[model samples]
Target: MTPLLVGVLGVFGLFALMIFRTPVAFAMMIVGYFGLWILEGSRAASAVVLTESYSAVSNYSLIVVPMFILLGNISSAAGFSRGLYDAAFAWVGRFRGGLASASVLGCAVFSAVSGSSVATAVTIGKVALPEMKRLGYGDSLSTGAIAAGGTLGFLIPPSTGFVLYAILTEESVGRLFMAGILPGLLLMTLFISTIVLISYIDPKAGPRGDYVPLSQRFKVLGRAAPLLAIIALSIGGIYAGVFTPVEASAIGAGLVVLLAFGTRAINFAGFRGAVLETLKTSAMLYMVVIGANILNPFLAVTHIPETLGNALVGWGLGAYGTLLVIILAYVVLGMFLDGLSMLVVTIPIVFPVIQQLGFDPIWFGVVAVIVIEMGMITPPVGLNVFVVKGVAQDVPMATVFKGVLPFLLAMIVGLLLIIIFPPIATFIPDTMFG
Candidate 1:
């Protein structure tokens, strides 16, 4: 029938396929290609698909994706997570709920290299969960803290999510990376504060257990020097304009390799494993990118996003009300869908509405990320929770979900803070890239 109706049906059908366990990339590509062919003759639609795929994939800016992915893969294999946790533990393990706080800091540090939330959750869980449980931390707090902290992987600098968002929205990659720094640190602080508050309320949740002596703590600090150096150099260098995003990723990757090699942590097996995993992950991501390109034009043809935006803007709701509605929608959608899929499916509609309301895209990116982070911890389909659960099969799923509640509250606060004060997301990018 009508083009708009066809677009509507296409989106629903694609989601239905995804619900039935079809791979997201394949589902979108298949629907998009056929829809375009139906809308335009087969030859013309096929040509459009080929051209979009090439242009999207061949852009030099996209090299950052693989380089950053390789950086994360290499660092993970090299045992950076252990060093990161140990360092944070050395400094904080003596404080109240110290182990839990260390988990947050460790996730933040590890995220600098790993950049993938699931990887952060899984890696840090392996390193932090055992110690937290051994130290008599409650099951809910221990599991929940790690699960919530892992999401910082996507918010912090060198984030894979940010990279993908930038590519899709045509925002500056470097600026988007810079935009993440403050919000990431602020959210990490919120998580830490949540742990302290919880522990304070019920000391039983996290027993002080024992305090390491200052002299011994210094020794623990020495063990973490490698991680500190890598984080400062990579993130700091990028901010200082010392390197492009791709170059910074490359440098980060190289440094991690050398450090891992020097420490004897990364051997032949680890090196090979890192490379292979990187290739596979990179390939999978590119495939998704290719699929999005195929599907996006078809969605545009439908004009549903435009129609929806106009309706929202036409409503008497002020900008703040509109934003609140969007965040609520994200939280609800997050319960059932993964963050990347949500982004691809919704940004076409959301971005235009947001821009029409006089908000900056970079600021909106930060806001969108925070909303998605909430989804990562929420029920029914929280990716980070499942990741932690997979590693912590002994812990009940409900306990893990319950523990992350405070952090989820904290994420909501973080989102509000950014919304009320846009500079929280824009200050760094404005100062550095303006």
Candidate 2:
């Protein structure tokens, strides 16, 4: 009967729906609508739903979602992913464990294209896994690298995770995008270093790649240039204040579409398929936003976030100790829930605790995103690991999980560095926007 009780029921019910195979978006929408009805009657609930849905859909900044999704989809359809992978291979494929390293690099580059971790994993895995196998690379190392690398999609600029975090917390999407850059590169470096260490311990696990001539490398790099340039122009333009995030997204998508057709890399049929895929993905994201918006209001009325924040701050745990608790909780939730689901479900409660602790919001965003990406390759529900498994069909799921263990460790180290330095996530944003 009490609002707080309804809010508690709504949280459990949301998880129950998700556990029962209900879509996260619809589940949130459902729980929030009915809970509001219970707390304050149907008119408020209906109005909340109507207004939030319209607001979510009509928000101009949100245009970035479909545009970026289209940019990624079109790039995938046009075979630009292959071009990027090939360029990476040419550059990094000569050293020990280089093929696996190349996969990481390829994922990092392609992360700038696709904001979704699954899309990044699948696209690069399709290209990198086969070549690694043919070159006699070990399954665990190859699959693990691709899976780990794919998580860059969640941490890098143009990331869906950032966009959703922005919408939820009302942070600047552009600053969050900027915040992600160095941390993403830091994680990429650590992943490559992990491959190096693995190779040093077991050379046969990651055999050295054959030589690639300088001329060949440059030639392949040239082939990969258009998409890279588009990525640069779009992301760079945002930082340089040359364009807004919405404009940058539209420009990126338009340029990729032009490149696809101009190079004859994608036909009308392929273009149509890309558009349809974009529509589906964008719609799902939009619905999630709407649902989160609707649910946030109900949660606010119950004062659950405020209560949690107070409880957390009341504890003797210092800022770092409280942070440790939150991170550990995320790891547990991540084992059962997908990254986006974990994100939306927790941020309302978590964000307040974070802000009350006097931690930097932008910095925490990177930390939160990196931790979620860790979940993408973690055990049980490891989303990116399964994506790599799906692509590298012969590799066992356990092998994929085992392979990611080292990279996951690398991610932790990278995360720790960010937590300690803080500048790793905030420096660029402060320098750019200040």
Candidate 3:
């Protein structure tokens, strides 16, 4: 069989495994190794696997992955998310649908620290949803807001998705992180605006609430200082060249540890849990990266991407047309696959095509992340919606899905703005690094 045929089969088979309830990492690893053995002889494929695994794991740049994860784990353990949400509430909670708006902004801030959508959804939903219910917010609107907002974790700075994308594409991780900043904020604003508009049109959807006292507001803000400090130090240190991205991660992790202690939030038991969780999660990320690294070379040998890329470019779809195709593909895949796994599965093939079509890699990374964010809130496998449902078990699944629709529309707008303007995502990265 032609190598191209083998590559195509591998792609479909990987999806089949995922649909059959296989773990994403295991499915990718199995298909990749098996495909390699078929394309080359088993002996050659085994040797390549051994060497690639070692090289991928030993690469020093990868240490940033664990450092960032550790930072997030520590912050989560320290209860930083609650402070962020509280502060956001104090500032925004007086508006009609104010709590829902606060949920979006709060999720954005918590996302900066946690960088995991499920974590953001559950954490914020736990804290914010019941409050919204008590305040008479509609169940659909309340559940949907948190579920949709949680997806910001993937697009925002300090994002694990962006980090993984940069590592795979060999883009500058710092620049990718920087590129995410504005677009992330833009999406957050869009989400908040959507909430306000919905509440304004149908006041019954979200009731107005009493404002927090100025003194209490200040107290909430004070509680958020540590999180704000860590965000500023980590992002600012990298941008200022005071430290490399890796060093910034180390510094961030260190700060989170200190914050945990300062807050007296981490007992020995909590600390051990944080460490073990970070270690376990980090291992999973590394395994996926290593497996993708092994699989990428095999895909390359097939020349399938090159063949498809040239054909699409020859079709003269122009930049926008090509981008539409990519986005459409992501939307479809979002239904069946988890976002990170979808990214890994497609990026090796798709990124080269994007670069060939003259799109900036950093900009494309942001665009790609936004597309994946859609998947997280989209059905029938919207991961974020499921997370929200877990938090509000009595809320129907359909209601959770319904809640995300407006934000999803806002996300669509945000994605289009990034596409047309480009600089919205690229400006910071270019100015800082250029």
lDDT of candidate 2 at residue 342, scale 0 to 100: 90
Error of 1 at 195 (Å): 0.6
What TM-score does structure 2 among the candidates reach? Answer: 0.99
Instruction: Summarize candidate 1's per-residue lDDT along 121-140 as a digit string, tens digits.
Output: 98889998989888889999
- Residue 60 miss distance in model 2 (angstroms): 1.2
- Give per-residue CA lDDT, model 2, range 1-434, as digits (tens): 77778888889999999999999999999988998999989999999999999998888888888999999999999999999999988998899999999889999989998998999999999988888899888889999999999999999989999999998998999999999999999999999999999998999889988899999999999999989999999999999999999999999999999999999999999999999999999999999999898999899998889888788778979899999999999999889899999999899879999999999998999999999999998989999888888898887898999999999999999999999999999998999999
* Candidate 3 lDDT tens digits, 210-277: 87999999998998988889888888998898988889888888888988887798887888898999
- Model 3: how far is 380 from its true place, Å? 0.2
lDDT of 1: 0.86
Instruction: Provide TM-scores for the models.
Output: 0.97, 0.99, 0.97
Where is the poorest 10-residue window by lDDT in model 1? 206-215
lDDT of each: 0.86, 0.92, 0.87
